[model samples]
Target: QQQVKQSPQSLIVQKGGISIINCAYENTAFDYFPWYQQFPGKGPALLIAIRPDVSEKKEGRFTISFNKSAKQFSLHIMDSQPGDSATYFCAASYSTSGSRLTFGEGTQLTVNP
Candidate 1:
């Protein structure tokens, strides 16, 4: 079974709008939640991450909201811009789970100018 699941196989947003992507995990052992952004012909880069200890984490226009009890998390892009257009993925892992990560299927995002 897929440990992590994400919604909205694709998304489109206008500039300066809000783009939200949600994720849910079945493994309670997952303690680390991270979001990655990838562009064509490039590898995914870690955009933001959160630990189970925090309810939310924000960096610039990127934010991660985690719900430990619900085993869910989401990424919210505020003031979305064309530069932010990319494929976003949500991942979950634990210290004991080795270096591998359980990733969501990914959401393709398009930010229109």
Candidate 2:
């Protein structure tokens, strides 16, 4: 079973616009929610994260909106720029799992100048 599902397999946004990617998961044991951004030739890097206690978390231009009850979450990029173009993955993991994460299918984002 695909524990997590992401929508809009690809997205195109203009510079200065908002880029949004959504994800839904089936597991309720998950506590750590994180988003990762990956460039073509580099590994995915942690962008931002949130715990179930909070509904949202923001870091600079990246924000993660989470809904614990609904088992859903989303990543929003404000003032998106060409440099922000990359593949984004939403992931969840429980403490018992250590560093292992259940990831959603990545969303490919392209920001136009």
Candidate 3:
């Protein structure tokens, strides 16, 4: 129940379009959900996150929709731009477990100009 499954291994979106990525988890014990965006040769950086208490959270053009009951969540990027292209990952972990995170396989997004 510690696995996080992500889909659409790759995605291509035109500039100004919206990019969507989905993820699901099996662990109900998980209380912290965070999304990370990584560029080539760089470590993953925290983008946005949500707790089970919040059904949705948005930061600028990035939004995260979470369904605690379904054990699923998704990330949406509005008005995607070429500069936004990167590999994104969804992760889950409990705060008590230190900084260790259980991550999804990852989704590569390419925004075309």
For candidate 2, write residues 1-113 as lDDT tens digits: 99999988999999999999999999898999899999999999999999999999989988899998899999999999999999999999999988699999999999999
Error of 3 at 110 (Å): 0.3
Q: Please provide TM-scores, in order, for all candidate models, with all chains considered together.
A: 0.98, 0.97, 0.96
- Candidate 2 has its poorest 10 consecutive residues by lDDT at 91-100
lDDT of 1 by residue, 18-88 (tens): 99999999988888998999999999999999999999999999999999889899999999999999999
Q: Give the lowest summed-lDDT range of ten residues in model 3.
A: 91-100
TM-score of 1: 0.98
Give the clashing residue pairs of candidate 1, or none: none
Give the alpha-carbon lDDT of every model. Answer: 0.95, 0.94, 0.95
Off by over 4 Å in 1: none
Better TM-score candidate (1, 2): 1
Query: What C-alpha lDDT, on a 0 to 100 scale, does residue 28 get in candidate 2?
Result: 91
Q: After superposition, how far is residue 105 of candidate 1 from its true place, in Å?
A: 0.2
